[model samples]
Target: MMRVLVTGAGGFVGKHLVSELKNRNYEVIAAASSSREDAAAGKLHGLDITDLAAVKAFIGRTRPDTIFHLAAQSNVMKAWHHPSAAVTVNTVGSLHLLQAIQEVCPGSRMINVGSGDEYGLAGKQGMPLSEETACQPQNPYAVSKFAAGQLVLQMAKKNNLQAIHVRAFNHFGPGQEEGFAVSDFSSQIASIEKGLLSPVIRVGDLSAQRDFTYISDIIAAYVALVETDVPNGVYNVCSSIPRMISTVLEHLVQMSDVDIRIETDVAKLRPSEVPIFVGASGLLEQVTGWKPKTVFLDGLERTLDWWRSRVGL
Candidate 1:
């Protein structure tokens, strides 16, 4: 069994990934940045990636066959408010891990998880983005993730390390928080179902289009990259399907039992954003034979159900 270490194991995607890895009988060592974010992480190893010395010591001790780098300051609004912190965690933290991997276990492969948001304005131009797409990185989070991916590629080439970056698109499913569109809609519907909030569902600009993959499908894509002997480069993990937020909202609203009124919440709106972001996962599929398996509607329904369960409905 290949021993794999997953950073940010407490996060939404991390939790799902960890479960799948364990189910596959991999030797998994899970670590989180702190105790507060330890729900899915198990708090087994509070490995702070920002601390260089600590990161080095932890990697040296674990010495796993592969390291899945998932740690990041993922919230966009938080990134805008604390750009330096975002850079510290997303860029510098990744550097610490790469440096540690180089020194302690040069043979260990690392999968640096990045965001599709790295494309920024460029994503707004094309129908579907590919690996060759130029990254403009609109926000602090996107900029930091883009920098981290570049740094990883550069270091991997120079040191001959087995490292690759993945530009993962928007993924949602059960147990997701209210940051993204699917979860936001689902959570509100769930809240209304549980009688926690009014029948009004407040929302932001819902005209934007995005590439959304089910969380399980996203995990499968990452696992495919791990299992297959693919080349060292950036790959997109997406469904290659453009989904409008309004359509997603309509689906969730239809799922609800109560009569709901839509209300535009100015607080929920972004300062500025790309109108659309759809990625081509052909490279990922061609290499790993991993096409998206879950239908978007099924995934959306499951997400709403998960939210309903959470609220004890």
Candidate 2:
């Protein structure tokens, strides 16, 4: 069996990825920032990527055949407030992992997960951003991720490391935290349906459009990339279809039992916002024959159901 080490294995996408890999009969090392004894227990291994010595020791010890570096400080707004922390965790932490891999597991194939926010403010160029498009990061999170991505690419070329950088767009599904827009909307809708809160959903910047991919699709893309013999470079994982936030909220309301009213909350709005953001996955498709299988409505329904179950509605 192939040995795989997945950082951030406790995260929303990381948990799903670990499950999928296990189902595929791969030996997966579920590494997380912290391990919960009740839920993760024996399966989860504690790993703080921010610590270079710790990262080096873990990689040297396991020497996994494949390393999926999904660990990062992923919140955009939070990054804005704590730029230094974001850079340390996202950029410096990535550097630590790469250096450890170079020293201990140079032959291991690695995938660094970057964000579509790396192409910030460039959505004005046109629809469907391609891999060749130059990244123009707008926020601290994007800047840090972009810096880490560039390091991955540079190390791949200079050190001849077998690594690939993935520029994943907006993705959401069941178990996602309320920090994201879709999850926030779904959670609010669930609370309203369960009579835990008022029948009003507070939202921010409903006019902004983003390319949303189901979490399952994103995991599939990662699996496909790891299994393939594709060249080392950056690839965009996205659905290429932009949906307005308002439309997504409408879908969630329709899926819920209670009638919900949308109310704009200035507190929820980002200081810097991109009007529209979408990505083209032509490169990923051509290389791996991977395309999103889940339709938008189906994903929305599943997310709503998950939230409803959590709220016992």
Candidate 3:
């Protein structure tokens, strides 16, 4: 059994990835920054990537055959308020992991998870962003991810490490936090259905378009990358089709049993929004033979159902 270590194992994507790995019969270690009780309940090992010595010690002890680095400060709005913290966690933390891996497990393969936000305003030039597209990270979060991704690429080139950088776009599903748009919308609708809130759904910039992939599809891509003998490089994991936020909200509303109206919330809007963001997965498909399998509406409905069940609607 090949041993694999997953960072951020308590996160939405991390949990899903860990489950998939277990299902595939890999010897898996779930690492998280959670308390002892929470880690025990989730079957995770407490490991904080920000602490260099701790990361090195963990890597030395586990000696995983492969590692999925998914831990980071992922909230965009939160990054705006705490840019320094975001950079420290995303960039320096990633450096710690990379260094630890080089020293303790030189043969270990690594998957460095990055964000599509690295493309920034460049998406305005066309429909689907390619890996060749120049990165113009506009926000602190994006900047941090971009910097970290660059470091991964450089290390892969210089150190002979089998590391692949992946830029994931908007992905949502059950267990996602309330801050993301899809989760927020689903939660609000579920609350309204349960009579916990008004029929009005508060939203940010609904006109902004994004390529939203189901969490399962995203995880499938990750698994494919792990199983394939692909070269070291950056690949975009996303649906090529861009859908407006308004369309997604409308679909969610239609799925709900109750009548609801959309309301623009200035408070929810970003300081600067990318009007359009999407990515082409041709490279990923070519390398790993992976493509998104879920329909957009079906994924949305499933997410809504999960939220409904959570709120007892």
Candidate 4:
């Protein structure tokens, strides 16, 4: 079995990725950013990704054949408010991981997880965003991811490490952080169902469009990429289909049996937010013969059901 180390294993995507990895018979070494109890049972390593010494130590100790660098401060709004911390954790932390891989597991394949936000407003004209698209990151988080992605490519080319960068679009499902739009909407709806909150669902920028993929589909893509003999390059992991937030909200509202009022929250709106973000997974499909299978409406219903079950509805 192949041995893999997944950073940020406690995170939403990380946890799901680790689970998928283990299910595929890969020995997983899960590394979390904090000392919290791991969500999945594995060789857990609690070490901050931003710490260079700690990262190097873990890589040396684990000696994984593959490193999935998924740990980072990914919230755009949070990165906007705390740019320095975002840079430190996302960019600098990624550099530390690369350095560790170079020093310890010199021949390891590294999958540097990146974001679709790295495209910024370039894909707003309804064209499918591709790996060839030039990165014009607007937010601090996007900037950080772009920088780390660039660094990964540059270092991989220079040092001969099997490093590939993956730019994943908006993915949502259970265990997602509450700060994201999907989770927030689901949580609010769950609260309404539980009588913990009013029937009002506070939202922002419902007109914006996103290429949302279910977490399981996203995890399957990750697993496929790992299994495939994909060359060291950048590829997008996303649903080619993009839908407006209004459409998603409409479906969610329809799925809910209760009357829910929609109210716009001024605080939720961000200046210079990308109105539409979409990506094409053509390269991934060509290489791995995988495409996202979950429909947007179906995924939304599943998410709603998850929140409902969690809130005891």
lDDT of each: 0.89, 0.89, 0.89, 0.86
Worst 10 residues of 2 by lDDT: 35-44
Model 3 lDDT per residue over 149-216, tens place: 89977987898888888999999998897988899899999999999999998776678788999999
lDDT of 4 at 157: 89
TM-score of each: 0.95, 0.95, 0.94, 0.94
lDDT of 4 by residue, 1-313 (tens): 8998898888888888998888888999888866666646455678887878998998888899888889999878899999999999988888888899999889888999999989987876668899999888888999999999899889988999888999999899988858777887887888887889888887766887888889999999888878888899998999988788867877787777789989889997763366767898999999999988887778888888888888753
lDDT of 3 at 298: 95
- For model 2 the TM-score comes to 0.95
TM-score of 4: 0.94
Candidate 1 matches the true fold with a TM-score of: 0.95
**What lDDT, from 0 to 1, does candidate 4 have?**
0.86
lDDT of 2 by residue, 261-293 (tens): 888899977633567789999999999999999
Question: How does residue 178 of candidate 3 score in lDDT?
Answer: 91
Residue-level error in angstroms, candidate 2, position 105: 1.5
- Backbone N/Cα/C clashes per model: 0, 0, 0, 0
- Any idea what lDDT model 3 has? 0.89
